[model samples]
Each structure stands twice: as structure tokens, then as C-alpha cells.
Target: MRPARQTALEKVLPQIAIESPEAALDFPFTPEKVWLEIGFGNGDALAHWHHEFPNTGFIGCEPFINGVSNFCKLVANDDLKNIRIWNDIAQPLMAALPDASIDRVYLLNSDPWPKKRHHRRRVIQQESLDTLWRIMKPGALLILTTDHQSLAEWMLEQTLRHSKFEWTAKCKADWQTPPEGWLTTRYEGKGAVAGRSQVYLTFRKVDCE
Candidate 1:
């Protein structure tokens, strides 16, 4: 991490860090909604969404210290109040959240762990899906994007088989198209330049009453 970002991590992080998952939703202000982003690499999308949705509280989880530092810098520079950081793996925080707590979740261009032997490390799995379904509000959206073809397929398969989530795509174009006003991250831009196709998947939590 650069000196400035390191300083941001040391100085700014304490003001917005989520020290406890049980109090994750207790923002300074009562936000209209809460969104969680797992593995928010580089914090590009997380920061973008924070600016775009000032009324929505954001919880960004990234195990990487550099990413957390970069995001903290943004928070300090902008004086953003509706954002919180969990600088660790997301599962523990997810488990701690109350049922039907989060309004949406984002898992964008996360580490694919492409090796077959490392597939277990991939974020999209049955147990994680169960946790996500329990935490997200009914009709809440889980939005995921990936430039890796195998990872895209794996995510689709895992999310589709989950009984509590219904894929919102009606046709091929739906998944192929990015959501309106999608913010392309630096990593995603590089993937596009390298001729990699991106897949956008959205699944809605089923009410299942």
C-alpha cells in the first residue's frame, strides 16, 4: 500500500470500520437500505455505489489490506458516512447479521480460484448461498459479475440450485447485459481489453411464504 493509503487505513478506518457484525446495520443515520459486497477488490465498485446511493448504507468486506486502505482513503477524501468496512472474510459477518437484514448483495468479479483443486475456495457455494438467503430480505437482489467463464458457470449453477433464489434473467441477453449505469472497475476494464466476456447474474430472494 502507498503511504497515503496506509495513513488512511490507520486514521480513517477507525471512524467507519465495522468492529462487530452484530452492529453492522447501526449506521450513523438510518439508511433507506443496506447493501453488502463480499470481496470488494480495490473498492472501486463499493466506492462508486456509495457515491451513487447516498441513502443506502454499504458494508464492504475485503480480506486484502490494500483494498481496505484504498477504500478508507475514499471515505476520508469524500467524508462519506454511509459506508462501513469489514476487513476480513465475509462469512463471519454474514452469519452474524439478522435475518432479512440486507437489501442487496454484490459479488463482482471476485477471485475465481480457477484451479479445479481450489474450487472449494470459490465464494459461491451451497453453504454461503444458504447464509445469503437467510440474511437478504425477501425480494432482495444478489448481483454477481465475473469475467472468468468457468467461474460464471459455477456461480450460475450454485445460485440456480438454491431453492430460495430465483434467477431474474428471462433470456440470454439478460445475463449478457450489464445492469443500467454499471460502473466498470479497473480490473473489469482490463478483462474487456483482453477480450474476456463478462457475465452479469442477478437472483432475487424468494419470499417462499
Candidate 2:
């Protein structure tokens, strides 16, 4: 990591880090709504949302150390207060959260895990969806974006088949176009330059348990 990033981690991480799953729900600052971003690669979109919705609390789960460091730098630079970092996989935090806790979820540019055998490692699995359904508030939005064709289709199919979520797309253009206030990340930009078409899948949690 660069010197600034390393310094940010040392000085800022402890202030905002979600030390445990139980600690996730306890925010230092009150927020009207809470948003979770799973695998927030490099924290570009997460930081954008935190800036855009200063009153909305944000929880970002990212296991990659470099990504965590980059996000720590953002927090330090911005002095962002309504965000928490879970420097690990999301499942534990999801499990620890009370029912209907999260207001929105972003699973953007997730790892494709393309190989047939590695499909199980994908984040949009049935078990993950089950937990998401339980934790997400009714009518909460679950947004997923991917440039990988196979992964896009997989995410759409998996999310569509889940009974608790309702697909919000009215037509093909809905998925083809980015949602309002979208933040194009580095990976998404690179994929666009490579002539890859991106897909946006949005689902609303309905009839949550």
C-alpha cells in the first residue's frame, strides 16, 4: 500500500471499523437509512454514495486488504462519519443483523467465479439471498451490476427465482440502462472500454420474513 493509504489504515480504520458483527448495527452517528455494499472493490461507489447521502449510514463489506486500505483513505480524506467498515465477508454481519435492518444493498461488479465448479463461490447464491431477504426491509432495493455476460445472466436468474424479491425492470431497456445516480467504477469503466456491455439488475424485497 502507498504511504498515505498505510497511514490512513493505521489512524482511521479503528475509528470506523466494524470490529464484530454485533458492532455493525451500532453506528457512531445516527442515520435515516442503512446501506450495505458487498465486496466494495476499491470503495469508489461506496464513497460516492456516502457523499451523496450524508444522512444515510453505509456498511461496506470487503475482505481484500488493499480495498480496505483504499476505503480508509477515503474516510480519512472526507472525514465521513456515517459509514462503517466490515473488513470481512458479509454473511456474518448479515446473520448478526436483526430482521428488516438494511434498507438497501449493492452487489456491484462482483467476482464472476466463472468456472462451473467455482460457481458455488459466487456471492449471489441461494443461501446468501435467503439471508439478504431476512435482513432487508420490505420494499428495500437489492441492486446488482456486472459486465460479465454469464455472471449477469446468472445474477438475474438467481435473483428472479428467489420468491421474496420482485424484479423492478419493466422492459429490456430497464436492465440495459444504468439506474439514476449510478456511479461508474474503475472496473466497470475498464470493461466498457473493452467493449463489454454491462447489465444492471434491480430487485425489491417483498413480503420479507
lDDT per residue as tens, model 1, 9-75 = 9998888888988877778998999999999988988988999999999999999999899878877
Candidate 1 residue 39 C-alpha distance from true site, Å: 0.7
TM-score of 2: 0.97
Give RMSD (Å) of candidate 2 vs. truth: 1.1
State the C-alpha lDDT per candidate.
0.91, 0.90
Q: What is the lDDT of residue 73 in candidate 1?
A: 81
Which sections of candidate 1 miss by over 4 Å? none
Clashing pairs in 1: none
| Model 1, residue 147: C-alpha shift (Å) | 0.9
Question: CA RMSD for every model?
Answer: 1.1, 1.1
**lDDT score of model 1?**
0.91
